[model samples]
Target: MKLDFNLKLTQEQRLVMTQQMQLSVKMLQMSGFELQEYIGKEVEENPVLDAEYDTNSNLKEKNNEIDYKKFIEYLNFDNYSGKNYYRNEEETVSPFTFISNKKSLKDYLNEQIIEVNEGEYTKEICKYIVENLDNRGYLDNTVENICEEIEAKKDDVEYALKVVQSLEPDGIACGDLKECLKIQLNKKGIKDENLFGLIDDCLELLANNKLGEISKKLKIKKSEVQRYVDFIRTLEPKPARGFYTGENVKYIAPDAYIRKIDGEYHIIMNDDILPKLKISPLYKNIVSSENNDNDNDTADYVKKKINNAMFLIKSIQHRKSTIYRVLEQIIDLQRDYFDYGKEYLKPMTLKEISYRIDMHESTVSRAIRDKYIYTNKGIVKIKDLFTVGISSQAYGDDISTIKIKNKIKECIESEDKKKPLSDQKICDILKKEDMNISRRTVAKYREELGIKSSSKRKRF
Candidate 1:
């Protein structure tokens, strides 16, 4: 082989985002409070910029009158579909989760394991073992490895593990998926050696639904293997399912206000949080005097500062105008959502909005992202207005994903716990309504809506 070198030329189109444009986009994306904090810093650092506080006089007490519980029940449609939710008159504040308070599986398991009346030293070793369990409650370290780590005997570790595995949820501590299921099944008085062998020996085969091969290997009937599979399915694979890594709530300050006044909806940009900005008269005088006296260097410096201050003010105004225009378009398009609720929200996209407003898609994205608008429903993120569309066969139009997800959630909510609806059945129901979609697509949408599979949702 020989080395060779050649020069090549190619032509391509590329879009370059400039610093000022990037700053403009950044300003567009920030919430009212966030923008205020950011601008405060800029005003302090720049000598030519100053602000006049207390700009908003139209602020009203109506912002405080939102029914928090009814709002929650509306948002959590999965739990409260067609169910009347009432707020407690005794409570004064919103019940939204503002902090992460849920106990992790590791911590929850450790608390129970330590109460087993085991020796203090040995329990300490057990604590180490519990700490090593992953989010799925599967032991990440082997018994031998944990024993070595804690400088304890292998028997002590094994006994500790047994104590933990005996706890609630039936399968708290295990080394693998097979062990977890077997432990739970054993607790149920299930003594099938073939079933245990199937879990330990061919777990992968079971997962892929290869019942014929397992039946032949265990010398059991195919239906018998399937029956065992169903039993195994009942056992929890993820012991830490309900307990999560915890979540916190976010507080939003809307940058725009939209509401109907005398049967006409009005859109107003929020100028309260952001201070009223202007160029400092003192700095402008300095620039003018320096230029008149022919002090070239000082004049240039002052002029440069004044120009920067002027540009920032203009950029900020431009960002506000663009956002207001975008919200106007959103209100015009998703008027149904405002008039009704989330269910009436029409399908839309940043690209579609960009085309309609004759702006770049990226600009439209930045203008709406992380920004909120105040309406009758309280504060909502502007980005939530844009949703992808699914085609409708009956109306020959595109239906919003929000609408489909809501329907799927409502269907699941109304389902009988003993006879849950399958994805295929859900698809058939949709088709009868002339909204044709595939079973797999239905399954995908169901998962997106956080609805579990029919088998998992079945009640005893």
Candidate 2:
């Protein structure tokens, strides 16, 4: 082995973190509500940065609204194809608003319990149980455990559980699945040991729609087992309806709205969420004009503050433009998805879009984080439209894993319950349909879709 001490020169590309990169990531992950909070914080912290709002000014005006149609018309047709001339319209413009009122899980539960008619002791026990309930509405402590903690009798805790269970939605205070079901079943006058035993023994089977196993175990007919299964299916798995109550829902406001107009889709970036920010002209002029020895330190300080303010303004502008560009790339790649919904969502990777948009994969990933798009269909998480692709048997055509999973769901739905399609059979069907998916893929897809295998799905 010869050791060469010769130096070799090579050129390599590297990514450096810039203010634009930092701002891009922040903008991507921030929802409208989060962005509002962030800007408010920034305005408070950055003395030079201030917000100017004109109540009469529309979002378009504040954004220096571009005439999309006129802009597109001015573009040379020879340089771009119909596909390249995509235009997106604004969907809706509304002021950024946030929910100032938020109740903790404990507070929400206590408020509901307060309305119920109960003795002081029972109320105290209920409060203890409510405090111990997990976010999923399951009681984190056993009745005995809670009784010991609160220095109350076990019977008193049990009575409190009964009161909580009897409250709206039937099963709120349960510690586990069995107790939750048992509470609901007891209320329905189903106390028979054999029937209850059937449920306990076959809940796994029952959940997968396997009534036949239950029937055979109980020495009853398939029809009898199905009757019980159907009854159980109606039971609420989530015991806390009140805790999860938000009927008239408000979702995150999208930073951009993509719309289809005259057979073309256009992109409109919503800058309304961002407060109007600029350096104070009066202060800037004063600082620039005062070239005196006595005001050196003051001038330097003012200049530094002004520079920081300008940087912040530029950061926000760059953030908006970067988000718009990233969204444009997403719209181009996921045109079918936006046009036709989830079924048409092609399998797309971050790298592919990043490459197309001349951005780093990580940049693209961050650019889409927690971002949303408001469209004719509704507000959809931008990231939801991009998924891993599953290749089809036919070369040049790839199917999204989501699509294959949906096909499997359809096959199962159309299958006779007595003879549900086996995983291998499902694969065969997909093959016949030219999807060319293997049995393993089919099984994986089935499981992902929460569809059980043939044996599990078989009814009596």
RMSD (Cα, Å) for all candidates, in order, is 8.2, 8.3
Relative to the true structure, candidate 1 reaches a TM of 0.62
Sequence-dependent TM-score of model 2: 0.75
Candidate 1 whole-model C-alpha lDDT, 0 to 1: 0.77
The Cα error of candidate 2 at residue 158, in Å, is: 3.9
Q: Please, what are the lDDT tens digits per residue for candidate 1 over residues 74-162?
A: 34532233464443221223447436566767667777866888888767876787778787878888888887877888888888888
TM-score against native, each model: 0.62, 0.75
Shift in Å, residue 419, candidate 2 = 1.2
Q: Candidate 2 — which residues are off by over 4 angstroms?
A: 1-34, 53-132, 136-138, 142-157, 200-217, 245-250, 329-338, 346-351, 387-396
- Point to the candidate with the largest lDDT: 1
Q: Compared with the true structure, what per-residue lDDT tens digits does model 2 show for residues 1-460?
A: 9988988999999989787567656765666668778778877876666688555332223367766554454343212236654432322322343435545556766877898888888988888887777766788888777767778888888888887777655667787887788888888888777668866787887766666667788888888887777677788777765454444455466887787889888888867666788777767775878455678887778788887777767766766777788878778888888788889888889888888879788877777788787787667788887788767657466888778888899999999987788999888988887888678888887787877688777765
